[model samples]
Target: MQFQPIYYDGELLLPKIELHMASCQAIGIVTDVKRKQLLMDQLVDHSNYYLFQAQQAEYMRLTVEELITFLNKITERNERVTSLMDYFALKEERKVKIKDLSPSKRMYVTLMRVFFAHQPTLVLEEPYFYLEEQDRRQLKRILEDLSKEKQILILTSNLEDAMISCDVIYRLNEFGFYPLDIRDSEEDKQEVLEQDQANITIQKISTKRNEKVILFNPPEIDYIESIEGSILVHVGGENYDCALTLTELEHRLLNFGFFRCHRSYIVNLQKVREIITWTKNSYSLRLNTDQDAVVPLSRSKLQELKALLNI
Candidate 1:
């Protein structure tokens, strides 16, 4: 018997890509804004796929709870409506209108609401920008779950953002879309090597206390914080003033499990005990130490920290 493929209008757009999506594939298209919009337009205008643009998509102006209730009606109770809502940590915002929610929250609701409503092949544009780390993680989970029966076409210019939940990545060139040889990329190889190396030596950070110099192992420190004009290095339960700049330390400890979670702090990912979400938007990292130090988390770098920590 001859095999049939999913229709992309009368003719296929990017035969190479269409052929690969014989089954649901989490595909990433790396391109600039103009090219991304062009692809989205083509998909919406010509294809049978559902396009989920965060800003432009139409989601019924329902409260979060109401949306879940509505999703249950469309795709049946089998749809993962409540779990998805919880995954995005939207339980507290159940009373607010979907339209009135924050940009990031609204984006999550729109994407999931559309999915449950149709479970259509998704063509998402710049889906990763402005997403907090937890939101991105939940989105990754959603995409992975949906990929079992739905094709996901993610369009973005940033490589790291594209790498989130994409199984196959294509680079858009002047000629056309081409496969990104990630395995052959030197930068990727270096990153893999760094992550693989188990033993990293962190001899010390030079410090001046009582007008005397001291050396301490970087791993022994819980975190580094910038206070006033001096850098404070937090050891087990005590703090010491360090001479080297935060930037310098970050560069040196990149191979280790250290991450600059915020502008004023660089944390040891190994010591991060838990991520506390104080508000819908605010987050902090609690460390596993005697003093139980807490470090500020940058909303922007949350995803980066997750990637580094493999959480």
Candidate 2:
């Protein structure tokens, strides 16, 4: 399916997207809630798409096995409920009512619709967000197996969640949708390298907002982000377009208590209030800000950050 470009008051919101999803690949799009809703709005009215939203409603009175049986009956799938329950690792909770399971387990049960969806494309929103590690593993395994038969598209706000199951990942923001390089292999890292060049000293960052140029001192900035290859200067609670590249910004901000926390993010160490470990490798830096700002921290950089802060 093809999606035309979307614009808002002369600014580009979403670029034209052409989907080719028949390669047994599960595509993941990491985006904010509003954009995810925008994409969902376009697919919700279509019959060829099965949209599994984050807050999907379930029959609270029905048991897990009953719900699976019902879905199989309605979808005309002949898969044995007992077999599916075992495959889903829900045999222990098979007799438990939907409302009785833990929040994580309940969400996992709600995510079972993907297995029975008749639509040509399965669009799942944050399927792993509320799931526990075991449930997450089960879902990832299920999604991988399902990808061979249907077009599976995952939409989530977390890159780490997307990385869990998706074969191909894309980042969608106001700038445009672009593929992200989340590969851990050194070969993939080398593919993204640029030729080394001399850097110049910079004190203030120049950004553009509403056709007006705004200059912010290095100390005033909270973090710098790279979205779709566009540098954005984030200050206070707002972001402005920056002409400089992330590498350039890194060089400029290197001496201002800033750390390259992730491949796409740079954070001011002075503002880092907490190091939130989602997993041993997946982590985030919570900033000491009023709006509860957080940034992704790469596992490869964790040791570097520890040394920088003497932690």
Candidate 3:
């Protein structure tokens, strides 16, 4: 997808990273706060070539149902508000006022409305900020659905968020946007393979419940998550404290389908029913267990997880 060389205030912004309008979802990681703001202005503000500014773009100005009715009157194409609500998991908060809604919730409704109006492009600034893990996953799915016909540009300082949502990614800097390395290097791949083959035995894991130690098989554990320096193991719809850290367990259980999905979580891929979109920055893997457990997924590991799941 080659784009015409684009310039912003006499600086090159495109062709360094080509963006096509055919269902393209692109993300730019700008760690520098100043650069991120500058890039946002360049992408979201109107230009000679890209005239649709973010503020001028369509967004939710009314309730979900009302917005749908309004769209039905203006556009020739009919879009269902019920479906949009379901897609964004807004069924529970359908009646909530826009002011009463949380930041993440408001963002979800904004995204739904923007896409329902069939806007050709969406320019978002730090879209994943403060989003919960579950909402992040839903937003990812929504962007994917919208990308079939619309272009999405996400600007954020979080690299993982960019990796999760964008088809083509770049880093914003003083020079311009530069393509980022998303693939594991050859040496790193070899190291992963060697690590995968070397240790396959993790017969049992020890955990304490109420200060009583219990042992469980590696296969019996659904997932392991670490929160705030404390490691917890999930098995049989229960959580127990494990002596081993997430890193230690991830290495021991690699052959057992346990993969590091996030910095705080290692999941048994075989138990994952589906990947839940939390936001553009975060993800969740829903387990097929009795409790329907979910594990955190990091943006940086998005491709690795997809490859592992064969998605």
Candidate 4:
């Protein structure tokens, strides 16, 4: 299905979107919240699309089993509630009212409506944002199964979540919409290794935008994230494709106060203003930037970070 260009507030939110959803595979569009909302709204206007929005209304008064039964009855499906409960891994909580379940569990139960959807195309918004790991796996599995017969479209603000279930992924923002290359081949792995063997020759990190190479000084970079075998150099509020591996960039930017904070992230310490402790062991570094960027600080690296700052 193709959508015409969309504009909101005199700014283009999306260009011509031509999407051909393949069967047995989910397609994801990694976009910002506003754009995701806009796209979802447009999908809602289409009667052939089944939109499963985040925090969609649920039967809070009904027990988990009752809710599933009601959905089955209304959809006129023959699948028994017991099997559905087991498939959703809700057998243990079947008797619990939707309101009594935890936020994650409730959202998981609410998502059951998708499995019974009659639409030929299913569109979901941030399906993994509020889910726990176990629930995420279950949902991914169900979506994969559903994709065998239905065209699935997942709209998420997170690339990681999209990678979990999407066979093909695209990124859309103000800069423009484009496909993200998440595939890793032997050549790509060799290139990374070859980069690791090279010494830092320059301080300016090279990145690409719109098929043009752009060099950035280390200080101007907010952080570098390695996502699904792709290196993204983030600056200000935008990100660009990077050819160099994180290890090479880390070695090049070490003299400029960049810290390898996580397995997949390297942050510019000069931009870090707060060490947020979300849990006893989970930590994040909040950047002092206009966009309020935050990156995860691995548990194993916390002590090293504290030692570096003399905390």
TM-score of each: 0.50, 0.71, 0.49, 0.69
Q: Who is ahead in lDDT, 1 or 3? A: 1
| Better-scoring candidate (lDDT), 1 or 4 | 4
Candidate 1 off by > 4 Å:
1-19, 22-24, 45-47, 57-61, 74-89, 117-120, 183-311
lDDT of each: 0.68, 0.83, 0.65, 0.83
Candidate 2 lands at a TM-score of 0.71
| Model 2 superposed RMSD (Cα) | 4.8
Candidate 3 vs candidate 4, lDDT winner: 4
Sliding window of 10 residues with minimal summed lDDT for model 2: 183-192
Which 10 successive residues of model 3 have the least lDDT summed? 47-56
lDDT of 4 by residue, 27-100 (tens): 99989988887787677555689899886978789999998889899989978788888888889998999999
Q: Model 2 segments beyond 4 Å from truth? A: 4-15, 22-24, 30-38, 41-48, 73-83, 128-138, 156-164, 167-203, 211-220, 270-311
Residue pairs in clash, model 1: none
lDDT for predicted candidate 2 compared with the true structure: 0.83
Checking candidate 4 for backbone clashes, the offending pairs are: none
User: Roughly what TM-score does model 1 have, to 2 decimal places?
Assistant: 0.50
Candidate numbers, best TM-score first, in rank order: 2, 4, 1, 3
Backbone steric clashes in candidate 1, count: 0
